[model samples]
Structure formats: C-alpha cells, structure tokens
Target chain A: MDIVILLYKGFTALDVVGPYEVLSRLPNAVVKFVAKQKGIIESEYSSMKMVATHTLEEIENADILMIPGSTTAFLNVVKDAETLHHVQRIDATTQWTISVCSGAVLLAAAGLLKGKAATTHWGLLDMLSKFGANPVAERYIQHGKIITAAGVSAGIDMALYLTKAVAGEAYAKMVQLIIEYYPEPPINISDFSAVPKEVEEAARAFFKKEMMKMNIAAAAMN
Target chain B: MDIVILLYKGFTALDVVGPYEVLSRLPNAVVKFVAKQKGIIESEYSSMKMVATHTLEEIENADILMIPGSTTAFLNVVKDAETLHHVQRIDATTQWTISVCSGAVLLAAAGLLKGKAATTHWGLLDMLSKFGANPVAERYIQHGKIITAAGVSAGIDMALYLTKAVAGEAYAKMVQLIIEYYPEPPINISDFSAVPKEVEEAARAFFKKEMMKMNIAAAAMN
Candidate 1:
C-alpha cells in the first residue's frame, strides 16, 4: 500500500507524526512525505524539520492521502490554487482520504467536505462551515472514504480506526499493542468546552495575530 | 530553555515526537534534534526521515536532554562507548534528563540509571536490571531529575507532567488545550496485561528477528 502524507511550510508535527507512527507499520505499507518542493519542510509550532521525500506533483496516486494541519500556514494552503488542484487530483484516486486538525479546512476548501460532517481543531471548528462543511465536535467523523480527525493528537485515534477499516480488527489490535496505544493524559481538563473562556479567547487571538504575520511575510516574499 | 533530543538511525518516530509535540510548545522553548551526525535520520519501521539540527559533539549542555527509543537500534547505541559517554556528559548538565520506551535502556547502559527506579517499554522492562536499574510498568516514573516513560505513546503523558513541573499547572493546561489533547483510543484493550499471550509472544519474536538482522548488518559494515 502506498501512503502519501502532504506537507507544507509551518505544518504541525504531531498532526502527521501521530498517524504515521501507527499507519506506517501496516503490512507492505510504503509511506512518502510530499510537499510542494522536495527537501526540508519546517513545522509551524516547533523547530523540528522533516525532509519531504517527493514533490506534490510527483505523486499522482496514493492508496491513502493524509493532510496534516497547521495553525496559520494552512490558510495559505487553502488559498493556493495549485495545491488545492493537487489535493483534488490525489483525492480522485485515493481509497482513503484523511485530514487532521485544521487540515479539514484544506479538504473543505477543495469542496471535498461539502454536505459532510467533519471535525477539526476546536479553535477552527466554526470556520469549517464557511467552506460548506458541517463542523462537529467529535474526536473523528468518517463520511464515506474521507476521515477528518478532531485535533493534533486525534490523528492517532483516527489512524487506528482507519487501520481497522483497511485491515482487520485483529491486525489493528496487534498494531495497537506494538505501539502500546494506551493513553493516560496527565492534564485535569476532561473537556475542552470546560476550559476557561479567557484562555480560549487568548489562543484564538494568538492565532489571528499569527495569520496576520504570515500574510505580511508572504507578501514580502512575493 | 534549550531542549536537546537525541536521534539515531532506526529510532522510533513517536518516542521522541510524542514528547516534542508537548514540550516544544513550552514558553521560550527551543527544541533541537541531535545525532552523532548532522543529517537525515531514518526511523526503524517507517520511511520517514527527520533532519538532525546539530551533531552530538556540537551540543554539550541542555536544560533538557531527551533520549528516544528504537527497537533494535538502541542495542547498537547502548553498545557504543562513545555514544554512552556523550549521554553521560549531557546528563551531567541537564536540569531534566529523560527517556522514552527502550531509551531507558540507553540511560541504564550509560550508568545514569544505576540504582534508580525507571520505566521503559513493557517488553524490555526486565533488561533494566542488567544495568542495576529498577524497572516498573507505570506510564512514567521520575527519580530526582530523571524521568523514564513506558512504551511509545507514554512520552506524551510524561511530557505533560514535565511541563507542569517546569512551567506550572495553568500553563501546562493551556498547552494541552492548544493541542486539543483529549485522547480516545479506538482499540478495546484497556490493560496491556489483558492481551492474549500469543500476540505478545509474536511481537517479541518479531523484535528479536529484527535485532538479529541488525546485528548481521553491523557485522557486514564493520
């Protein structure tokens, strides 16, 4: 099976790595990291840099195509004509098309999430509706072959479900055992809705400021 | 704060990445991936390659030093006197020295875990005894400034605790909320001990075979 994970400047690391850790272990799986350009792709929130093995144009088909989200960088991706065209091109041939976190915005931007229930990073949940997607708050929602996971860490859960769908329950459980997928969060917050409203507002403001900065930087580059 | 994560050929992706996703977001945190060589480092089971930001020798001190695990590659790392010496040198200076999964084995081999209670991947818990370290099956255990986490995904939980220790509770919860880290595993297995004995045995056999293969490859290279 050929699995292609999309990458762009300022992409979130865990959004892709969490799913990669689980899905890459599938039998006969060959995973490729593809970006607009071949070489290093820096993350949005971390100093970590991953090497893109192939260019987006180079990969025309994938058994699975994964799109990982970013805080503000995804806005640029959603607005790019060439990238959206490629996402649509790949989606045309994939057996499974998945997005994590704000990545759903990119899929929804491409018209793939129209009339579909989807989920994304809590901060961006309402924005999905602007692109014709029904924003839900679940960990993950599968509408046909397109699976959209809630946030950064939700990709791990979504991948296990995808594994069960592609392979069998037995194989998925074995993979879970191999990774020791038992999660024990140390934080006291059980529900994101329960978080202080001020904190959520502050985070949203930070993201908005970041988007403005990204726009300035992009304009300067042009 | 300067955070240095050690990487090697065939290292597990999630062992380090899980923690990176959490810790890299700490206030004023700068996370660096370091290896013996400064270049692309490949994972044990995946085709993913990460760029090492600095060579091990270039970095002598870190506020936090993290060692991520590999299935068979860790055996090579433990056997190398130079690598063990570097680990010791870095551990001596770190405010916090940590390991994930079999990374505890590397710390143990370096004499840092001697007479200390630590934890590692469930399959290799007993191996810590060879280096005079006590192994437990908890998600993570901290002894003084050193923390050892169990298995792959445990690093996320361990990092949340470390965040609380360094930055306090409110900041940690904010970071947790930023990532939207509410985990919901799709697999039904709650406790690893409840897994069928055959499945665990099969996974162990697979690791052993991979270790043997790695040894043969090392011999050929030498």
Candidate 2:
C-alpha cells in the first residue's frame, strides 16, 4: 500500500505520528510525508520539527491519503481555496481518504464530505455540519472511502480500523499487539464525560476559540 | 527549564513525541532534540524523520534528561558502553533523569538506576531486575529523580505526571485538557491481561528474541 500523509505546519504531531506508526508497519506499505515543500516543518503546539519526504506534486497514485489536524495554523491552510482544490484533485484519485481530528474539516472544505457522514475531534464535532457533513461524534467513523477519527490520539484507532479494512484483521491485530496498545490509565480522566465538571469546563474553554474558527472556516468553504 | 531529549536513529517517534507534546507546553520550558549530531533522524517504527535541533556536545546544564525507546537495533545504541558512559555523565548533573519503555534499560546500563524503583515496556519488564532495579509492572513509575514509563504510548502519561509534579496539578490539568487526552477506545486490548490469549502469546513469541538480546546486552554492560 502506498500511503501519502499531508504534513502541514502546526499539525498536532500525535495526529500524524499515531497513524504513521500503524500504516508503516504493513509489510509492503510505502508511507510518504507529503508537504507544501520538502524539508523541516515545525508543529505549532510543541515546536517539534518533522522532515517531509516528498512535496505535494511528487505524491501520485496513493492507496491512502491522510490529513492530520492542528490547533494553530492548520485551519488557515485548509481554508485556502487553492490548497483545498489541490486536495480535491488528490482525493479524486486516492482509493481511501482519511483524516484525524479537525482534518476532516479539510476534506469537508474540499466538498468531499457533502451529504456524507464524518467525524472530528469532539470539541469541533458540532461544527462539521457547517461543512455539509453529517457529523458523528465517535472515536472512529467510516463513511465509504472517507474515514475520520476523533481528537488527537484517536488517530491510532482510525489507523487500526483502516488497517483492518485495507489489510486483513490479522495484520491489524498483529500491529496492535506489537505496539502494546492496552489502555490502562492510572486515573479515569480520558473522556470528558468521565472527568470532573471543572476539568471538562476547562477543556471546553481551552478549545472553544479554535472550534469557533474551524466552524467559521467550514461555513466559508461550504 | 532546559530539557534535552536524546534523538537516536530508529527511535520510536511516539515515545519522544508523546512527552514532547506535553513538556513543550510548559511555560519557560525549552525543549531541544539532542542527537549524536544535528540533522534528521529517522524513527525505527514509523520511519518518520525528525530534525534534531542540537548535538549532544551542545547540551549543557539540562534540568531534565530524557531518553526514548526504540526497536531492537535502535535500543542497541543505548547499550553501547561509550553511550552509557556519556548518559551517566549527563545524568549526574541533571536534576532529574527519565526514560520511556526500554529507555529505562539504558539508564540501568549506565548505572543510573542502581537503587531506584523502575519499570519498562511490560513485555521486557523482567530485564530491569538484572540492572539492580526493583522493576514494577506499571504504566508509570517514579522513584525520586529516576522516572520510567511503560512501552511506546505510555510516555504521555509519564510526561503529564512529571508536568504535574514539577509545574503543578492545575497547569498539567490545563495542558491535558488542551490536548484532549480523554481516551475512550472501542476495544479494551491495551494490556496482555485485557487482550486475547492468542494475541498475547503471539506477541510474546515475536518479542522473545528481542528481549533475549536486551538481557544479554544488559549483562555485558554490567
């Protein structure tokens, strides 16, 4: 499988890293980090630098096309009509289009998810409808060739699900075991619903501004 | 705080990245990717290349020194006596030293965990006892200045705990919410005890050979 992952400035590293870890494990899978240019691109949150393997023009005939989300400048990039046009062109030829967190917003911005069901990070889920998508707030959602996962770390679930869908379940299970992905947390604070009211409120407040911007951007694109 | 994270060829991208996303969020925390040399280092599992910002010789007076785990070949680099000696020298000056997964083994080999309670990737937890550490099969273990987290993804939890311990609970909670780390998985297969017997057995079979090599390397270092 030839996978092309979009690496934009300010993307959440986990959003890209989680899926990359799983997809690259496939025996014959070829994963490419496609960016606006080839070289170092800095993520907004942590200032971690990722090296891009290929430029956007070099990526062609990919089995999977993935877009990872960011809290800072990713929305601005997706809102660019020219970039969205380029993504739309790529989506037309890709076998499967996948996204994590608000990356679904980019797919929706490209008019790929019109009238289709999709998902995004929970904080931004309600805004997905603005992009003409029937938003489903789940960890992982599959609507035909378009697959979206919720939040930053949920990309792992989406990747595993995609692995099962494209490769076999046996391969996906093997990858899961190899990564040792058993979720035993010391505290039960993983889900907003499970956490304290104050924690949830704080989280909502933290992301409210970004969600609003994404909502506005999705509407403008639609 | 000046934090230097060792970046080696074939290191697990998430093992470093998960903690990086959290640690870099701290106010006045300057995190640098320190490698043997400065340039791009390809991760073992994902093959994602990251650019190192500084060389090992450039790192001075680090408040925290972090080492991330990797696959077999990458893990072997840490076991090298010269590398261990360098790590030991750095550990002596750093206020706190930490490792994720088999990174603990490197600390042990450097004689940094001689009397510390430590842990590593659960699959290879048994090897820690050989390095004079009282190994615990937990997700995150902190014995004073030496902290160790279990396999690949657990680095995030360890980082959050460290953030709370150093910065304060409120700050860590804020960062956790911003990252939206409330994990809710459709499957409960993150640990050997939670996963199927067949899956556990298959993983053990696959990893046994690597674990044996780690044991031999640790013995040689001692």
Candidate 3:
C-alpha cells in the first residue's frame, strides 16, 4: 500500500509520526512524505523536520491519503491554492482520505467534507463549520472513504482503525502490539467537566491566542 | 526551564515530539534539540528528520534531559563514546534525566541507570540486565533523577508526568487539555495475554529479526 502523507511547512510532527509508527510497519506498506517540493519540511514548533521525498506533482494518487494539521500553520495551508487543488485531486484518486486534527479544515476547504460529519481538535472545532463541515467531537469518524481524527494524539487511534479497515482486526492488533500503545493519560480529557473549569478556560484562551497569531501570519503569507 | 532532547539518526520522532508537545507549552519553557553536531537527524523509520540546533558539546547541562531510542540504531548509540559521555556529563547537572524506549540502554551505557529501576521496549527488556538496569515492564518509571518510559507510545505519559513534576498539577492538566490527548487504542497492549499467541510470537520474531539486521549494520559502522 502506498500511503502518502502531505508535508507542509509548520505541520505538526506527531500528527504524521504517530500514524507513521503504525502504518509504516504494516506488511509491504510504502509510506512517503510529499510536499510542494522534495526537501526538508520543518514542523510548526520549529523543533522537528520531515523529509518530503516526492512533490505534490510527482504523486497523484495513493492507497491512503493522509493530511496532518499544524497547530498554527494549518491556517496558512488552507489558503494555499495549489495545496487545496492537490488535496482535491488526490481525494478524487485515493481509496481512503484521512485527516488529523485541524487537517479536516483542509479537507473541508477542498470540498470533500461538505454535508458530512467530521471531527477536528476540540479547541479548533468551531472553525470547521466556516468551511461547511458539521463538526462532531470524537476520536475518529469513518464516513465512507473519509476518516477524520480529533486533535494531535488521536492520529494513532485513527491509523489503527484505518489499518483494521484496510487489513483485518488481527493485523491491526499486531501493529498495536508492536507499538505497545497502552495509554495511561494522567487526566481524563474526553469529559470537559473532568478538568477544572479555570484550567480549561486557560487552555481555550491559549489556543485562541495562538490561532490569532497564526491567522495574522496566514494573512501576511497570503 | 531549558529542556534539551538528544537527537540522533534512527531515533523515534514521536518519542521526542510527544514530550515536546507537552513540555514546550510550559510557561517560560525553552526546548532545544541537540546532537553530536547541529544538523538534520533522521528518525529510525527514515520517514522524518529533526534539526538539531545545538551541538552536544555546546549544551553541557539541561533542566530536563530527554533521550529517545531507536529499534536498531540505539545499539550503535550505546557504544558511541561521545554520546554516552555527553549523557553522563549532562545528567550530572540536570534535575531530571529521562529516556524513552531503548533510550534507557543509552542511559544505562552512560552508567546513569546502574541498580536503577528502568524501562524499555518490551521486546528488548532482557537486554536491560546487560546494562545493570532492573528492567520493569511498566509505562514509566521514576527512580530519583532517572526516568524511563516503556516503548514508543509511552513517552507521552512520561512527559505529562514530568510536566506535573516540573510545573503544578493544574498547569499539567492545562497542557493535557490543550493537546486533547484522549487516547482510545483498539487493543490492550499492556497484557501479553490480551492478544493472540501467534500475533505475539510474530511481534517478538519481527523485533528479533530487525535487531539482528541492526546488529549487523552497527558492526559494519563500528
């Protein structure tokens, strides 16, 4: 299976890396990172870089199409005409289209999630509707060929589900065993009330501030 | 807080990114990726690269020191005198010395984990004994300044714990909420019996075969 992951400057590394750890190890799975050009693509945090071996023009179709969202960079990416064009083109050719976190925004921008239920990072869930998507807060949503995962960490769960969809439950379980993905998060994140209201407010405030910064940057870029 | 993460060729990307996503958001936190030399460090699967901003010699101490392990490349890293010496040297001044997966082997090689309860990838748990580490098959272990996390995915949990330790519980909870780290894995990876025997056998065998290949490659490099 040719699993091509889209690489954009300032993309979140974990969104790609989490799924890569699971899908790359699949039997005969060929995972490729593709961007506008073949070179080093630095993630948004300025902490990590991923090599894109192929350009968007080089690969037109994939068995699995993965689009990872950046914490702040996704703002700029959605406005890139070439990128959305490629996403729209690839979505037409791919068997499965998967988006992580705010990556659903890009998919929605490409008109793939129009009149479909999808999920994105809880903090940025409101933005999905601006692109005409009915946002659902879930770990992952599988509606036909489209699979959208929530937040940065949900990519692993989404990928495992994708594995089960493509291969079988046994194969997906094998991949899970290899990663040893027994999660023990320190706090309950699913239920909003589980976290203190003040802390949650601070978290939302922080996200809003970052998104504002990203919006300004995106406006300048465009 | 100055958090320095060691980056070497063949290191796992998520191992560093997971911790980074948590720690970088800390109030007044500065995270740096350092290597033997400042350059692009490709991850184990060859899917991603991280830019090491500081040379190991330039950064002598860290508030928090993080080391990520490779499935095969860690063998070479454990034997690399400069890396072990740097690890030992930095550990002397750091408040917390942490290792993820086989990274504990590197820490053990640095003489930091002797008689310490450390953890690593389950497939190579027995090898921890060679480094004089009391291998514990747990998600994360904290023995004084030394902290070890099991496997690839466990790094996130370890980092959150570190966040709570460094910051307060409320701050850590805020960071957790920001990431929306709601994990819902498909299978139980903690208990070996939770999975099928043949799948477990395949996982073990696969790790063994890859280690053998890595062993050969390390021999050639040395």
Best by lDDT: 1
**Cα lDDT tens digits for candidate 3, B1-222:** 889999999887777777787888878888888999898778887756668989999996789999998778888887799888998898899999898888888998888888999998877787788889899888899999888998888899989898888888888889887777768886555565567888877776777777677555323221
Model 1 scores a TM of 0.94
Whole-structure CA lDDT of model 2: 0.78
lDDT by residue for model 2 (B1-222), tens: 888898888788888888888788776888888887898888874448998888887765688899898766445775577667768777878877889888888888788888788988776676688879889888889888888988887888888888888887777777776666766544456565666677666656656655575565433222
Stretches of model 2 off by over 4 angstroms after superposition = A204-222, B208-222
Residue pair clashes in candidate 2: A10-A44, A181-B190, A182-B190, A182-B191, A183-B190, A190-B182
TM-score ranking from best candidate downward: 1, 3, 2
Report i-RMS for every model: 1.4, 2.2, 1.9
| Chain A alone, TM-score per model | 0.92, 0.90, 0.93
Q: Per-residue lDDT for B1-222 in model 1, tens only? A: 999999999899999889999999888898989999998888885468888999889997999999999877898898899889999999999999999999999999999999999999887888898899998889899999999999899999999999999998777877788788878788777768878777677666666667678664423211
**How does model 2 score on DockQ?**
0.49
What is candidate 2's lDDT per residue for A72-164, written digit by digit as tens?
Answer: 466688668876776887888888999998898888888999999898876677668888999986777888898988878788878888887
User: How would you encode candidate 3's per-residue C-alpha lDDT over A1-222 as one tens digit per residue?
Assistant: 889999999988788888888888777888888999988788877656667988999986898899998777887887799999998888888999999998998999888998889999877777788788899988899889999999888999999988888888888887787777878886556555577889978876776677677556323211
Candidate 1 stretches greater than 4 Å from native: A215-222, B215-222
Model 3 misplaced stretches (Cα beyond 4 Å): A215-222, B188-190, B215-222
Count of clashing residue pairs in every prediction: 0, 6, 1
Q: What's the TM-score of each model vs. the native?
A: 0.94, 0.88, 0.94
